[model samples]
Target: MPAVRLSDVAQDAGVSLATASRVLNGSTRVPGKAVAEKVEASALKLGYVPNAQAQALARSRSGLIGLVVHDIVDPYFATIAREVQQQVFASQSQVLFTQTDREIDTEIRALRSLIAQQVDALVLVGSHRYGNDSDAALTALLEGFARNGGRVVGMGQSLGVGRTIVPDNAAAAHELATALIVGGHRRFAVVQGIAGIPSAGDRTGGFIAALTEAGIEPELSIEVGLTRDGGHVLAQQIQEHLAAAPDDPVGESLPLCVFAPADVMALGALGELRRLGIDVPGQVAVAGFGGVPDADDANPTLTTIALPLHEMARQAVDWVLEQPDEGSAIGPEGSEGGAAHEAADTSPEGSAEETPSEVHVRGDVLLRESTALAASD
Candidate 1:
């Protein structure tokens, strides 16, 4: 069978080829209601699919959104990706998704591919910075994309590029730590996420700040991947700490509060601990960030800073799809911002403006059984 073309639709609709193109190809020049209805009906009957490139050319819009995430398998990013995909589809657009696996080169490659595809906008989730030369190529690609009038939405404050939605990671962690302290948790350990990723740093940094304020220092600050594998490594460290004081059974009287900045990592650590026959909140209490659904389902429910992952991802979609009248070029210089994406002021002192290029979101702390301080028998 031959592919159905514009000519076929036009012939079936008893309209000109140009009229069928205008009606089905998303040309800005819409035909009259009756003509459009006729063209659409004929195309539907004929099973004709409009060429995406042709539609893009007709409307000066691609109807495509590029979403680049660190790891789609990570529930945090998975939730965001799911929300973004749904929202974009609702807007009659499609999402072009790519995963970076937390590697800079992979992310750079993904960005290059998306740019080449000429996606109308982009939503970048959970890419963190190492604050060095590794950032150069990534920065260049983002800058060039924005310069070329492509809209970009940043899910976290990685390099502060693009119109950003920042979660109050530090404050949320601070509050969670303070809550644990009030609950009589003394000995503490923080399993940090990938070094240099802003989300990991902010969350772990926030937790440490609370300890510092209480004149309490953590017994351990271990750095690891923000993934489950990182949690496996964390469980080993916990075992070492327990061995140092095996006399107390590592519970109640000497329980350790192990905090992982991301829920995936925390869940990872929890699973490993259970595998090692170490009881949670009995021997060790655990908490994590992002509040992924799996946290609630863990053997011992996990504690976490429950961020509005779905809503935040929605905001990223809304920003990218809505797009400013003239998108502000993304960089340290900031863009011409008369349109606002509202949130807390994390920007510098003199950088205040009537409408901001960035938005801030806060998370809620949930203390679950995973972090309960149960007394020993």
Candidate 2:
């Protein structure tokens, strides 16, 4: 189908090309009021739509926000992305989404593409792989974006590049650990995600730290992909491990608890457990992170950490739309602050310049049937 161009509207309204452009593009130099009304009516009648890119270039604002995530299929990322889309839409702006599959280089390419497209701001949602050359390269790229007047916001890992909404992964995992400990199960196993992702490390590390602090060493630690298939594979591994001591009941003769740290993985693990004729809580209690909407839909429900995904995404957009105060950039500290910004103060040295800020969001622990207290015999 052919698009309705400005010329089409002009001809239909018996107006000049320049007049049609002015009326449709919000140009200050519009024709007479009567002519403008006629052109608008023509556009409406013909369903003419202005070119957003051309309009953005003329106004020096694209009205487009860029969003990058790991996997859109994952509920964690989906929830946040939906909120971002809603918030951006509310502001008369739109979102450009990209998925990197947890690859740093792929993420970098996505950001670069968004930058080339002249997006107003960049919002990154997913894990951060820090302490590497890629991290330095990413920092350089973000710094360049900032220099070009583009804003950057992070969700899980800050990368120390922009305003970051960090979730207290470790603290939440610690709470989960505490809950499991109080439930009277000691021997433990972990089905962890890809090795270098900081968010993954933070969750597993926090749980392990808490167990160590309690003088309990975990029995098994299995590394796998950050997918449901990974969880299923981990389930197979568990079945093999338990088969060696078939006579001993899990959480009793062997006394075991499993932590997957991600709801999808835990749910997959649950399916595998049922396939192997294992009873949850009765055989091995399980816990996960990310209180996805369907957590309660699992056969026994899931015990996990519920993150404020909508709030975080909404704030990401809000921060992007917010005007930086004179001198300092916006931080996530005060009423107008968040994380850190560029050292170059936009305001005078003596004046109150807003610094860049970091907004750390905490997760709530939901204890459900999967990780419920063991039944006393």
Compared to the true structure, candidate 1 yields what TM-score? Answer: 0.87
Can you write out model 2's per-residue Cα lDDT over 1-377, one digit (the tens) per residue?
Answer: 89988899999999889878878886657789999999999999999989976566444467888899888888888888998998999988889999998788898888878888778778988776645689877877776666556677788887566578888999999988987887676788986656667788889989999899988888888988777887798888888777786554433554467898788888888888888888886777778898887677997898899988787877788777775452323345422322122233342222232234577778998889886664567
The local distance difference test score of each candidate is 0.79, 0.77
**Model 1: clashing residue pairs?**
none
Lowest-lDDT window of 10 residues in candidate 1?
Answer: 336-345
Candidate 1 structure quality by residue, lDDT tens digits, 171-226: 99999999999987887898764666877888888999999998878887787788
Report how far residue 102 has shifted in candidate 2, in Å.
1.6
Q: How close is candidate 2 to the true structure, as a TM-score?
A: 0.82
Q: lDDT at 134 for candidate 2?
A: 92
